[model samples]
Target chain A: MTIEFDAPSRDKLALEEGTSFTPKFDANGLITAVVTDADDNALLMVAHMNAEALMLTLDTGIAHYFSRSRGKIWKKGETSGNLQTVVDVLTDCDQDALLIKVRVAGHDATCHTGRRSCFYRSVRITDGVPRLISIDEHRHFVPSEVYKA
Target chain B: MTIEFDAPSRDKLALEEGTSFTPKFDANGLITAVVTDADDNALLMVAHMNAEALMLTLDTGIAHYFSRSRGKIWKKGETSGNLQTVVDVLTDCDQDALLIKVRVAGHDATCHTGRRSCFYRSVRITDGVPRLISIDEHRHFVPSEVYKA
Candidate 1:
């Protein structure tokens, strides 16, 4: 049987200070997850998690996410061989979001583009027009080669 | 006049590699925003941004978010004097999410609980039940006093 979570407490103080792990899912039963590199604390990727994905991550210590477009549980890095092993899972003040620190296996990458992080570019405004510029050039693996269809 | 974002590209490669700042908002016209400290890169908070909020943040160089609960634009830390000045704004591979690096002013705290980061607790399983534990106990200010109604 899958481990069940307690219903979120109505008591504001108890919800913030208590030990119960009652995550407040959105209307779609999804919660935002922020992923980071465990070693350097680098911001890697942001994904969503449904109840099942959250439970599996908690149970197996492997990172799993809900793919909004695919409408199913995604075993992250399953295709890219960059499986993420959970180092820590943290929740925010209201418990609506999560911060997941992980040690990535295989290519040690977290992005499908083979970059260590999905956020490999930074936004800049030039002549009042915002533009994205690539800042991180290092790729641990080749995406086309790894994600063979 | 607020800056207008370009329409999201139909081409997948262009969407990922293009310089345009076309964000993919969900059906509710909002995108996920992950905030972090500029100095230490600590995960500060996870919020949402509507088009107006995103435009304001980019134009004014200040962090703004859309509060899902309140259904309005939120100038973060406006009431508590913890205003965040954006240092860098980054979009992920698909441009559906954003990673905002900021230098927080005033109390230097992000959470309403007077914590530097909203993610101050870690989840751990005790006897096959997940429980949260207060990991970062450094309160920068007193919440009750700071947020006196």
Candidate 2:
């Protein structure tokens, strides 16, 4: 069912107070969004969610976010179809952020550019020079035909 | 060159104070990490960075994080090799968080599960029920085979 935004609820107020159960948000009015595996607490991904997006997430039980690039509301899997089914939404002690636990639908792939998570690359130092660790293969998810402009 | 995390020099402290930069750490002693674009202003991801991972990131210019599950430092590309190269490290106003801006190396793929980002799913309301919006194809990255074993 659609959950309405309760701007004055005890839960929301408690979050505003920075109580022990609130999530923390940054100065830009965005909360740190984290997704974890429910069974083992394995971190799935880290993202950002704004108030509108958070409200949408609460209402729809699907993840929604504000895209910095397009500067608009982004619905996950809109282009790809791999969706995150929300199991629960958690807030840290500060109430300005959230930890969203979800069960990934279809495949485990959540990234758009075609990795598991957005953080695929590793940084390494060699002889005082920093370089990217290389991987063996490259995969593409959406065919070039799909988003052909 | 090898950058040292020496105690902030007087000038450094002055600059830090002038900029109101403060680093935040979680209960696990990990800094609150924020990912931004190349300009270092557009926020991309909000995650955590432990001391070891932060040091490694600084030394190697690749993003490293403490995987709460694996209970060790995880280099971004250890498996898939889509790496985030460190461009700059920034602190927030309260000295309780950090902003890490990086240049994604290799492919545009950043997510682990083969999406452009880790936030590929969306929450939508269907028939008055919160439902996940699904996408069609899967591309790019491979699943974590080791985790299944």
Candidate 3:
């Protein structure tokens, strides 16, 4: 016998009006948005997606986000060709944040600076002092086409 | 006029007896732990530190973690030289988990296998299919000699 995987219906995906998504803030008081992949398992990106962006994400299949530095709404992969295709959206127990699982298309890089994501840097302590581990220039992969204006 | 930074007294450094340092889990079921550097201001790693490992971290400066894969206590830098130098610990509003901002030390890499941290991989969606951006090989740093043995 053969089995098939059926996609969830739209009605099943319909969330309670005004009670679908929420964002959680950490100790630093910064809102955290946990995004996952389509299978509902793999975490994609941990970026902040605000209320407006959340609504836009729901309205459109593409993921919309608020860039902390740019201070504006950024459609994922708009310039980099690394667009996020929204599959499912969820929230933590608290109705303050959202968990969006998306499928990325076009370019594999998600960060504007040419890295796959914004969280490429790692913080380390040496000699009892905090320091950032520097990435070797040769090992770094930044697509030039994305950064070109 | 002049100003100076005075070191903390031994008494000041000690936690009050009977005062638990563990974090309180939030309504969202997320745990928070804080690891401060020597100066005690800037955050290092914002990782989800669980109960068992949290206790281990308190017991020993060498961080012990709950391996999502092995599902057991994993001592930080045990296999990899990227050890987390745990400094001060803190909790969130609810006090369930932790925001472990450790001073990462030893080899620049932290991931058990050889990446900078465990989160070097990025998930993306292409044509409604979830995919991973394979950038783990680009991680240049390797574990130090001590842990390699």
Q: What would the TM-scores of all predictions be?
A: 0.97, 0.47, 0.41
Arranged by DockQ, best first: 1, 2, 3
Q: CAPRI verdict on model 1?
A: medium
- Give me the candidate number with maximum DockQ: 1
Q: What is the interface RMSD of candidate 1, in Å?
A: 1.3
The DockQ values of the predictions, listed in order, are 0.77, 0.05, 0.04
lDDT of 2 by residue, B26-104 (tens): 5577766756556423333456677678877887678898866578888876666667888866443223455566776
Cα error, candidate 2, residue A55 (Å): 1.3
How high is the lDDT of residue B146 in model 2?
20
- Candidates 2 and 3 compared: the better one by lDDT is 2
* First chain TM-score for all predictions: 0.96, 0.72, 0.64
Model 1, stretches more than 4 Å misplaced? none
lDDT of 2 by residue, A6-39 (tens): 3323564344222122223455666767665555
lDDT of 3 at A46: 57
lDDT of 3 by residue, B37-129 (tens): 334332222345455575566656666666544667777766555678765443321223333446767656554435543333333434433
User: What share of the reference contacts is kept in model 3?
Assistant: 0.00
Error of 2 at A126 (Å): 0.5
Off by over 4 Å in 3: A1-31, A38-44, A134-143, B1-149
- Cα lDDT tens digits, model 3, A49-116, are 65566557666778888876588888978876778988765432222344466777765545444544
